[model samples]
Target chain A: MKLVRIFFKAVTMELSRRMAYKADFIIRCFILVINSIISPIFALILYTTTPGIPGWKFEEFILFQGTLIFVFGFTHAFFWQLLSFTIYEVRKGSFDRFLLLPYKPLSYLTASSIETDGFSEMFTGIIIIWWAFKKLGLSIFSANFILYIYLVFLALVFHYSLNIITASFSLIFIRSWALMDILSSLVIFAKYPASIYHIGMVFFFTFIFPIAISAHYPVQALLSAVSYKLILFLTLSVSLFFYLSISLWNFGLKKYKSAGG
Target chain B: MKKYRELTKIGAKIALAYKFDFIVSIFTVPISIIVFYFLWKTIYAYSGLDVIRGYTFEEMVNYFIMSMVIALLGWSNIERVVEYDVLYGEMVLRLLSPVTYLASLFYTEMGLKAMSLLVEATPIFLIGIVFFKAKVFSILNLILYAIAVLFSIGLVFLISFLIGLSSFWLKRISGISRSKKLFLSFLGGGFVPLTFFPKIFQQISEWLPFQYIRYVPINIYLGKYSTFLALEMIGRQIIWIILLYIIAKILWNRAIRKFCGVGV
Candidate 1:
């Protein structure tokens, strides 16, 4: 609860700082919104040209893309700055400042760093999801909606864990920004329907890495196509992943011999 | 030219210094190819068609590979560099240098891309050849492709330099650069082939200089155009390059005046 309050306060401060550069902020957000919509737009173009990823209609695919974008936007807004700043500070041997702070280093770092463009991406995702739901005649007040929300929450947890794990690498490697690109390559597999990938990839995305938790299963929950067994497994896996990430952060922190300036 | 050559060497050395980062980045291209391969493979199988929009599954994969190549070749971050220098007052230091600013940037970018060609693009091209049997090795096609790519590099540099020049007026050009990048990738057929675009977009793209950036070069490599037609496309690229060079010069003179007037 305290951490959440800190996160909100930091977010408010960051928002005000961004608003100080009104033109730049607005233009950056507008560009980000456009960037966020590219995947959905690509899906639309594909669907119009040919049958896109079997067993999925245009609107369904749009929803899946929207869900991925929303999850990405959420992570980008709240956690991505933590990863980059960790790398930057570690590289400059200035990361010990976090340790000197009153709060837990990871929690405080995560709370403080916020990106303004992410809100625009999140807004674009919401618009896309709403448009798709309208086109599909789906209601937002159903049991499925509750399940979708739960899964999306898990997805957020999954991304937060991933960010922590990646940021922890910076403590050890000192220049680990390239690790984020690998995460991007892995996470992109979830941008489309899992049916399009090989069965092995689908299994890997669901159980092992579980990037599909960010989009695929959440969309399935909304479509009422998800299985209880998969949800049970996702819940366990995401919990384990989060545990691993925190454990890794502790390990990296212990291993840290600060590059003292 | 001698100073520019020295600058290029320095740029290449800087890229080499980031070799570890480049190695990790190499993983990205293959993963992108894998995703495109599976997605298109499923699309073709479900549609029960051998070809859609003049692309077989193999051809489509090859198109993506060539698109990646063209993208690497044409990539420029001069706008961002310019933005930084302008906003941070580093432009004054760069102005003390002997070589022209944009020329120095162009050569440096070329050197960076040249090294990346060896580190990144070559391996991806090889993967296309070995795995997808991408037939992009015809002599005539290769010649035209090289010429077109040269023009593409110039065209991209001028466009980015012009965007950077706008910083003198706007004070910040990150949004412009980002928008230009996203728009170029989409409209230049980097994301999808122009053949798959709607009729109106296809017609609109024909008139845009962007198509020459990725689409025309890749298509020439794919032998989608005859030798005469490929040469004609290269001619169009040269015209765009010349026109853009003119515009960039005009913009640069005005931007310098603005900078001087403001005492920046």
Candidate 2:
């Protein structure tokens, strides 16, 4: 309870600091809205040019894209600072302050930075998802929909694990920012159906990287036919990725030079 | 002229010192290429051998590969410098220099990126041409394509300049800069061909300036337009460049005045 209170206090302080920059914050929110609007325009172009991209209809693609934007907004809202934690802290030699704190470094790092712009994208994403669902003729209240939501939670864990793994690399290399950018761009692939690729590559995405699980599998579970084995594989992959990321993070922390100390 | 050349040489040397960054950026090209390859490949598979948006599967792949290369070559890191100067108050020192800060920074950064482009493109070009059996243009076409590419680079530089200059007003412009880059990639046909866009979008994109940087050059290289049409397109690009350049200058003057007034 005390730890939770401390985390909340840190989060509140960060939010207040973010709020102080009102103009910049509002501009960023507008940028996010523009970004959300533009993504669907591209997807619309694709859908119009080609009938359907293998295993995904026009509405299905919209759902995938909308869900992706939605989930990304959620992650960015809560943990956007994780993306820059290493670079900011290392440059300021403030990372040592995190180490000095009683709480886990990851939790502290996450709590200390919040981007309110993400809330704008998250709001837009929810609207897009609802529109996509209506277009696709999916039953929103079905028992199967609940199972799909569960899988989405699993996928979020897997997605967060990939980010944690990559961010952990910051301890060894200061230039991990560029690598993170590349990785984030690669995540765009998950916004489409995995069946578009070869089965081997799909397997690679699901197991090796887990991006397929991020959007492809859960959406498939919700709207298309999927096997129990695939679900089990996805759950196992999420657990394995989370474990590896945590272990790698611990390993990287030991090698951290921490700018000053 | 001599001073600019010397500064360019120095910039190239500094870029060479960061060999790892140069190498890692090369990896970025293949990732984009593979993603588009799969995307268009999927489209082709579903549609069968019919041409969509005037591009066959193979042709679309070639177009995107070239677009990716051109976009990489035309890439600008001016925002980093802008953010640095704005946050650290280094703009004051830069303002004191005899040279126009934007022009000097532009030439130096462009020269550095041009040199890095050669290093990055050599391997990709070789593999793309020799292994992939990608189509090559005639010698004259290649030269014309090079001119178009230089124009595209100028257009991108101006855009980046505007984004960077906005930092004078906004404390943090990275999000805005990123959003602009993303917008360009989608709307400018960096991710997919602009030809595939709806007619309304296609017409709109033609006027947007972003399309001139990526789509116009690549389309010209792909022989999508005749020589007369290509020249007209290049003229349009030049117009956008001049317009953006003027806007950037006005913004710079006002932003600096504000900065001086506030003493931030």
Candidate 3:
């Protein structure tokens, strides 16, 4: 309870700081939302030129893009600053301050910072998902809302895990930002359908990196494409990723020798 | 000119020191190409048509690969650096430097761009030609393309310089810079060729200077526009260059005045 309270307080503090600059925050939100709007436009162009990507129609694909934008925007809002600060502090010797804190360093690192611009993603996502559902002749608020929300939660964890794993590399390297950027950029593949890529890529993103769970798989589950086996697979895979991520961070912590110490 | 030459050499060496960043920048070409290759492959395979928007499968792939190559060549860390400089009062160093700030920046960008061409762009350019087997252009077309490539790089730098200059007043430019990048990339046809866009969109893109930044040069190499159209393309590019150069100079003057007024 105390730990949760710490996180809550950090989030509130971050939000108030962001809200301190009203115009700046509003413009950032607008820009982020506009940037996200481009992906759907990309989808629109492809669909117009072609019918769509094989089995997927343009409308159906909007949900996939929407899910992706929402997932990435949310993950990035929190962890972009988190990992960036982790690296900055590590480099500048400010990390010692965190070490001095009574609470765990990992918790403090994860919970303290938030970006309000990310909320724009959720709003845009809702708009896209609703419009896409309407165009596809499906109910917007189906009984699967809870299931979809739960799957989104799983994807969120997966995203957080991926971020931490890349961030852990900064412990040893003088600069790992490029590596993190490359890894994050590779998620562009997951925005499209799984069937479009080769068989090997499908397996890699699904079972190995499991980026598809963030958007593609969740959309599939929402579309009733799988049986109970999907849930089982998701639970197992999410657990495995979360475990590996934590292990990686601990390994980095062990390797860390404070820069300015 | 002597000072600019010295700064350029220093900039190249400084850029080369970060070898990992160079490698990643080069790697982005293949990674992006692969993803888009799969995407268009699906699009083409599903459409069951030979030509959509006048781009064959090979041409479409080659176009994107070329755009990525061009974009990689033009990449500069100037905007982010400028934002930080304004934020933390690092602009004072530039202000105090004996060399003119914009001249120093231009020299550094040229050095880095030259390094990218030698170390990153040329190898990838050759590999793309061999691997993608795009339409072979005539020697004269290649010469024309070479001219446009220089101007395109200049255009990108000027646009970024203008955005950086805005940091003087805005103070925090993350949002403005982000918006600028999106506009540049989209209108520059970094993702898809402008020809593939809806007619209205293509028109709008043509009106903007961004299309002249990449689309004009890449399409020239692809042998899409020729004769009068090619001349017109290059003509518009040079015109926009002059226009933006004037705009950038005006803004630089005002921004510097504002900086002095505020005394950062």
Candidate 4:
């Protein structure tokens, strides 16, 4: 409970700081909202031309896209600043200040900066998801729905783990920014159905990089096409990736030669 | 003319210093191209049609390869310029430069993009020839296409410069820059051919400068347009370039005035 309170307090303080730049905050949120809307407009255009994409119907595709957006929105809203923290802190040699503190450095780094503007994307995602469900006539209270939600939570873990691993590269490389850009583009690939790729490509995304688990697994679970074996595989993969990322992060930290002033 | 030559030469030399980044960008191109290849292949497989929107599977692949090259060559990292200038107040020096700041920046970007394109596009083009059995163009056609590509770069540079200039008024312009990039990709037929869009949207997109940056040039390269038609398209690009250049100039002037008044 104490830890929870401290986390909330940190988030509140970051939010207040962001709110101080009220005009910028509001404009940023508006831009994000418009950006989110544009994706659906494209999807609508596609639906109009074709009855549905192969394997997945138009509504289901919308659901998949919405879920991916929702995950992105949630992650970016809460942890967007985490993406730049390592680079900025390492470059400024201000990371030592965190090292001087008693609490976990990673936790403090994560809580240092929060972008409230990202909340607009999160809100837009929720609306999109709701629209998809309503259009598909899917019952939100069903057992399958619960499973889908669980899978999405797991996918979020996989996504966050990948980002954390990429961001930790800042400890060694000054130009680690491109790594994040590459990873983000890789994540955008997941916005589409994964069955589109060959089985070999699926294996590559699942075992090699784990981009498949980011969206494909959750959408598969929701569609009820994914077997229990696959679900178990995906869950274990998420855990393994997170474990690997944490280990890699710690290893990279030791390699850090604090940027010379 | 002498000044332009000197500027271009200087720009080319500075870009050559970043050999590591140039090499890294080469690898990134294949990742996106591979993704799009499989994506379109899957779509075609599901449709059970060999052609869509007047493009065969072979032609679509060719179009995308061309689009990838065009996009890479024309892409502007103007947001970095904006962030650096705004945060460090280095834009003051830029304003003081006697030559047009936009021209100097565009020249530097063009040099860097040209080098990166050569490094990246050579491999992709080779693979494309092997896989798609791509056809060769005549010398005249190649020359015309090169001119189109340069104009496309000029058009993209202007658009990106305008977006960066907006940072003078808006605090966080990265999102705006991102959206503009995505918008161009969509409207410019970088993702899929603009012909696939509905008639109304397709017509609307034609008037937009985005199509001139990627779609028209690739189409000309693929022999999709006649000699006269290609010339007409290039003519249109020149007009858009002039229009955007005027807008960017006006915006820069206003932004500088605002900055001076506010003492930023």
Candidate 5:
């Protein structure tokens, strides 16, 4: 409860600081929206030129993309800064400040920073999802909707795990931003439907990295019923992944050395 | 010219000191290309077409591979550095320097590109040609492509310089710079072939300078244009460079006056 209050306070301060520059803030949001839509627009071009990835119409594929944007936006809003802040502070020898705070470093860092631009991405995603849902004539009030919500929760947990893993690298490598870039590049695979790739790739993405769970499963739930066995597998695997990530963070903490600013 | 040469050497050294970043690109670039390959390969296979919008599957793959090469050769981050400089008052020291700021920047970028060409771009170019069997152009066409690329480098630099110059007025240029990058990648045919775009988009792109940045040079390499047309496009690139240079000069003059007025 105390952590939640501190997080909200920090977010409020961050929001107020950003809101001070009205034009800059607005333009930043607009740019983020543009960034979010570029992939869909490219997909539009692909679908126009040729039949897109088999077994998926443009609208359905768009729902997949929209779900991806939403998941990524959510992760970006809450956890993206933790990676950068850890790296920058560690490199500058200022991370001791965080350690001196009367709270756990991980919890305090995660709660204090929020990426306001991510809200624009999330807003754009909701619009795209709504548009696709309308076109597909899908009803919202179904059992699958509840399942979709649960899967999205799972997806967020998965993303938070990934963020923590990267943050752990920052503590050790001190210049692990490229690792984040590589991860983002790899995540591009999840933007497409799983049916298009070879079975090997699908398996690798699911069991190994589990990036597919971020968007693919939630969209799958919306479009059709997801199997219980798959859900059970996802729940267990993601929990294990989260556990591993935390272990990595603790290991990184042990390895941490002050730069002595 | 001597000072500019020294600045270029400094830039090369700086890029050399950041060898890890070059290694990162070595991995990131091919990963992007691989993703494009799989996506397009699946599209072609499912559509049951040998060619879409005048590009065979091989040609399409070659196009993206070449896009990566051209992207590396033409890449510039001067705008970001400039924005940081202006915001942090580092521009004051730069303004006091004897060499011209913009020319210094151009030379520095040239040095960095020269290093990238040696360390990164050469290997990718060789791989695309040898492994991917990218199109082999005639000597005359290769010369024309080089000329087009030189102009492209100039055009990209001037555009970025102009954006950086805006830092004099705007407190932050991240939004503007990112928006520019998004448009450049999309309309410049970095993302997809302009031929695949709708007729209206193609027409609009034709009137803008964006396509010349990536599309025209690659198309020339692919022999999509006759010799005469390729020359014409290079001519247009030079025209755009001249126009942008003039705009940059005017902006710089005004920006300098503003800086002097503010006594920074």
Candidate 6:
């Protein structure tokens, strides 16, 4: 309950800050919207030349991209920004300020910052998903809706796990944020259906990397309708990746070398 | 000129000290190439089309590889340097140090870029040539690409300097920096080839200056343009350089006058 209260307090503080910079926020959010537009348009253009990614229709691919944007919105707005702050503080030898906190550092590290600009992506994602849904002839009342929502959340968690794993490396390696930044850009690879990838790629994304849960698997479930069997696989992969990430995070914390006070 | 050379030497030395980080950063290049490679392969396979927008699959991949490499060459954190120094009045130290601040900062940034080129770019290119059999440019085209690349880097620096000057007014320029980067990527065709863009976007981007930074140079290397066209593109790049350089000079003066030395 205390940690929950702290998390909410952090969120409230971020909300207040967002309001204080309303003009700047609007400009950035608008720019981000403009930037994200290129991807879906690129997808559309690729589809124009060919059927696009083997089994995927243009709408289905849009759905995939939308789901990715949605998941990225959450990570971009919440987890990733805080991780960046942690990197900066660590490098400046000022991270001891956080380590001195009464509460667990991870709680503050993960939630204290918010990137309101990503709300633009969320809006864009909603539109894309809505369009995709209309094109695919799905509705809120569809049984697959519940499963799709569940899987999308699972994907978000998986993405969060990836960020945690990346952030954890900061404990051992100085300036590891560069590596994390590179890994983050790899999200572009997941925007299209995995069906287009080689068999090895599909397997790698499914298990080894597990970014598929974020966009690819969710779209697959929505289009094909979910089955209990597929949920089992999804649950397994998400759980494994999440569990590993948490373990690494804990190990990194123990390995961490404190900087100047 | 001697002072500038000394400052550049210091910049290059500082960059060399972080040699490992520079080398490690380039791993992203290969990762990007692989991802784009797969994406295009799937697109081509699904379309069952050899040429889309007048690009063969090989040419498309080669285009991206070259574009990304060019981008890495042109990349500089002019905003971070200018913003931090201008806001913190760290520029005062440069003034006291008896060196041209602009020359010193540019040298430092270029030093990092040059290191990246040697450590990250050249090797990737060599490997790409053997592995991807990346675009075989004519000698004339290669010479033209070299010229284009020089102008492109200069133009990119000017544009970035102009953006960086905004920090004098807006202390928190995270939004501006992000906006600038995204706009540059979109306009420069970093995300996708301009050829693949809808005709309207292509037309609009052509009116803008970013295409010279990545698209034009890569095209010259891929031999996508005629000698005449290559010359024309390179000419545009030179024009942008002159145009942006003038704008940057004006902005820099105003930004300095407006500076309040908030942190200092």
Listed per model, the TM-scores of chain A against the true chain A are 0.94, 0.90, 0.90, 0.92, 0.94, 0.90
Instruction: List candidate 5 stretches off by more than 4 Å.
Output: B127-143, B261-264
Candidate 2, residues B138-202, lDDT tens digits: the string is 55556667788888888888888888887777777767776877776777788778877778978
> DockQ score for model 6, please?
0.51
Cα interface RMSD of each candidate = 1.4, 2.3, 1.6, 2.5, 1.5, 2.5
Candidate 5 residues B148-184, lDDT tens each? 8888888888888998988788767777787776677
Candidate 3 overall Cα lDDT vs. reference?
0.79
Q: Which scores greater on lDDT, model 2 or model 5?
A: 5
For model 5, how does the per-residue alpha-carbon lDDT over A1-261 read when each residue is reduced to its tens digit? Answer: 788998899889878878775666778888899899988898888888888998788998898889888999998898888887887788787888988999989999888868887789899989999999899998889898888889999999998998889888888877666777776777777767776677898887777778789888898888888898988988888888999999999998888887622
lDDT of 2 by residue, A1-261 (tens): 665676678667766776666766677778888888777887887777787687777788888878778778877776657757766666566777778988888876766556676788889888888998888788878866877788878877876777777778776675555666666777767766787777898879988778887677778888866788878888888898899998998987898887732
Interface RMSD of 1: 1.4
Candidate number that wins on lDDT, 5 or 6:
5
What is the DockQ ranking, best to worst?
1, 5, 3, 6, 2, 4
The deviation in Å at residue B86 for candidate 1 is 1.0
Q: What lDDT tens digits, residue by residue, belong to model 4 across residues B70-150? A: 776777787658756865678778767777777778766766776766666666667667765655566666677889998
Q: Give each model a TM-score.
A: 0.96, 0.91, 0.93, 0.90, 0.95, 0.92
Candidate 1: Cα lDDT at A46: 97
Which candidate leads in lDDT? 1
Worst 10 residues of 2 chain A by lDDT: A172-181
Model 4: CAPRI class: acceptable
- Superposed by TM-score, candidate 4 places the C-alpha of residue B134 at a distance from the truth, in angstroms, of 5.3
DockQ, each predicted model: 0.69, 0.50, 0.64, 0.41, 0.64, 0.51
At residue A53, give the lDDT of candidate 3: 85
* TM-score of chain A, model number 6: 0.90
Q: Candidate 6, residues A23-77: lDDT per residue as tens digits?
A: 5566677778877777788788777756667777788888888888888887888
